[model samples]
Target: MSIHLVTGAGSGIGAAVARRLLERGDELWLLARDAGRAKALAAGFPGARTLVGDLAEPSRLSWALGHQAPPDRLDSLLHIAGVVELGDIGDLTPKVWNETLAVNLVGPAELTRLFLPQLRLSRGHVVFVNSGAGLDAHAQWGPYAASKHGLKALADALRREEHPGGLRVTSVFPGRTATPMQAKVHQQEGKRYDAERWIAPESVATTVLTAIDLPQDAEITDLTVRPGR
Candidate 1:
């Protein structure tokens, strides 16, 4: 069974991906923000392991992971945890921008760095769960979109650098998924939250699984998922 480390596994797309992996008997490692969240995730996933590290504080992830026992043979690293705050660029503060970049971009970069040895050994794949806003920024999505756009850059550069080392990197840009983040987005936008109108988290999970499960002959560099309804 291949082992995988996943972030943002508490809910929505992350949770869906975690569940599907577990159901298939893949070894799972979950990254939680704190001790309490780690404990809760352990309970929720039964056999899965948990590591405590806050993505909001990217600099400390090294110290945090140094204190814990991470998986030594990871087949995949799933960067799925993210945070979003909607506001006009003028109203967004430095704190907001820093926190968004820390969680969405820098943290993933650091995590990938720390896990590179194990991943390289296994020829693992790295999947970034990005947003469509990474490609097109809307009025109130300044910071979040900026972070995601940086994520796309990270994925592209990593893919080029690691290609000879047998590493696969894929960016999945999903649009308007029915997630808790989406609900909050709608609330911030002063609109009704309708789950049915958005893409299902499970649908995105399927895309992720397909990318990793593809034969070693080729790689899926980027994927975009949108709501059909």
Candidate 2:
């Protein structure tokens, strides 16, 4: 059976992806910060495994990667854990800036590094859940935008470097998905951002599954999924 590891598997797109993969008869390992949430999610799936650790912590992530019976090869690594901090330049603080970068860019980068061996062993694929902000900058989204931009560049560079080894890397940019993150951003703005009109997390999850299911000889490279007006 194909073994897929997904971060941020406790909710939203991650949860949907986990369920979809399970339905397809794939073994899934979900990583999340909240043990309770992870357990709850795992319970919903008969054989799925859940690991609790903060991806932002290098030591914890390293331990999780090392101790796990390194899958003969990981079929896919979905780096989906991320955070968005919305604020103007004046409202930005060091803590908020660093937290956003840590979760959105640094953690994924570090996790990829630690899992490179397993990925190479399986010649597996890596998928990044990026955002539209990664492609275009908007006012008051400086930190979030910058982090996603870095993530996009990182994914591209990794893809190029690993192509010879058969490891495919894809960065997906989804525009305004109706996930908890969107709710948080909307709350910060004190208004809804056309929530009903936005794309659903399930749609984004389908895009991710598509990227993973592509033929080994092909790579999706970069894909952008957006809601139609």
Candidate 3:
């Protein structure tokens, strides 16, 4: 069975993706800020492992994942953890910007780097769960948009650097989804939080699984999933 590592496994898209992978009997290593939630989610999968820590701080990753032995190869790496803070440029503070970047961009970059050796051995796929904001910034999405933009750049660079080695890198840019983060965004925008108006996390997970299931010789470099208009 293929082995995958998924971050942000506590809820929303991350959890959905993790569940899908486990359903297929693929082994999973999940990382989340909520240890209890992670453990609970992995309870049904005997091959699943969970780690708890702030992924934004890469220094804590070692300790968080220390309980399990390092794998000789990793089939996939899914960077799904992210933080969103809504505010216009003038209203946003440096702390908000820093936190956003740390969680969305820097942390994933380091985690990918750390897993490179194993990935290289398996010629694995790396997928980043980006947002539509990464393509165009909205009035109050400065910090989050900037971080996603940076994440896009990171994915691009990784694809270029690893393509020759048979490592596939994909960036999945999805529009607003029915997630807790989207609820917060809607609240800040003074808009009603309507789940029907957004894409389902399961839909995004389906897209991700599609990318992972593609022929080994083919690569889906970029994927964009949005709600039907």
Candidate 4:
């Protein structure tokens, strides 16, 4: 069985992906900021491990990855943890911009870099759970949109760099998923956002698993999953 590591495993797409991996009989390592939530979610799985820390913290990420006995060189690393903050351009602050970029781009990139040796050894795949915002722009989503755009570029560039080394990368751009993040956006906008009718966390998880299962010779460079009208 292959070993998989997933970030943002406390809830939403991250939780769904962890469950899917467990159901497939793969060993799973769940990284989340909440110790209780991570432990609770990992309770039922036989080979699941939970690491609690903020992904935005470089030292925490390093400690989590190296503190424990490393699992048999991960077969897959899913960068599913992210932060979404909605606000008009006028509302943008240094703190908001920094936090958004830290969780959505910097942290994921640093974590991937730290794990490159293990990934190269296994010839594994890296999946970035990006958003439609990464491809297109939306009003009042300045920080989130910019961060995702940066992440998309990072994923594409990494894929190109690792192609000859047998590493595959996929950027999964999902639109308006039904999650707490969506609720936060709607609340911030003070209006109803109907895009929620299309994307579900489980559906995104399925797409992610499909990308993970593809043959090494084939690659789905970027995937866009949107809700159909």
Q: Say which candidate scores most in lDDT.
A: 1
What TM-score does prediction 4 earn? 0.92
lDDT to native, each model = 0.96, 0.86, 0.87, 0.86
* lDDT tens digits by residue: candidate 1, 114-229: 99999999999999999999999989899999999999999999999999999999999999999999999999999999999999999999999999999988999999998999
lDDT of 1 at 99: 94
Of the two candidates 1 and 3, the one with more favorable lDDT, higher being better, is 1
Q: Residue-wise lDDT of candidate 4 within 1-229, one digit each (tens)? A: 9889898776788888988898888989877666676667577555798766576675577777676665659889999989988888997899999999999998889889987888999999999999999998889888999999999999989998998999999999998898877877788878686645768899999999999999877988899998765
Badly placed stretches (over 4 Å) of model 4 are 44-46, 193-196
**How do the residues 1-229 of candidate 2 rate in per-residue lDDT, one tens digit apiece?**
7899898776778878988999989988887676677778678767888766676665567776555554456889999888877889897999988888888888888878877888999899999999999999898899999999999999999988999999999999999988888888888888867678899889999999899998887889999999976
Error of 2 at 194 (Å): 4.9
By the lDDT metric, which is better: model 1 or model 2? 1
Q: What is the TM-score of each candidate against the true structure?
A: 0.99, 0.93, 0.93, 0.92
Q: Candidate 4: which pairs clash?
A: none
TM-score of 1: 0.99
Question: Which residue ranges in model 1 land beyond 4 Å of their true spot?
Answer: none
Worst 10 residues of 4 by lDDT: 63-72
lDDT of 3 by residue, 15-69 (tens): 8998899888898888766667666757744578866656677677667656656
Q: Which parts of model 3 are misplaced by more than 4 Å?
A: 34-37, 44-47, 62-68
Model 1 residue 195 CA deviation (Å) reads 0.2
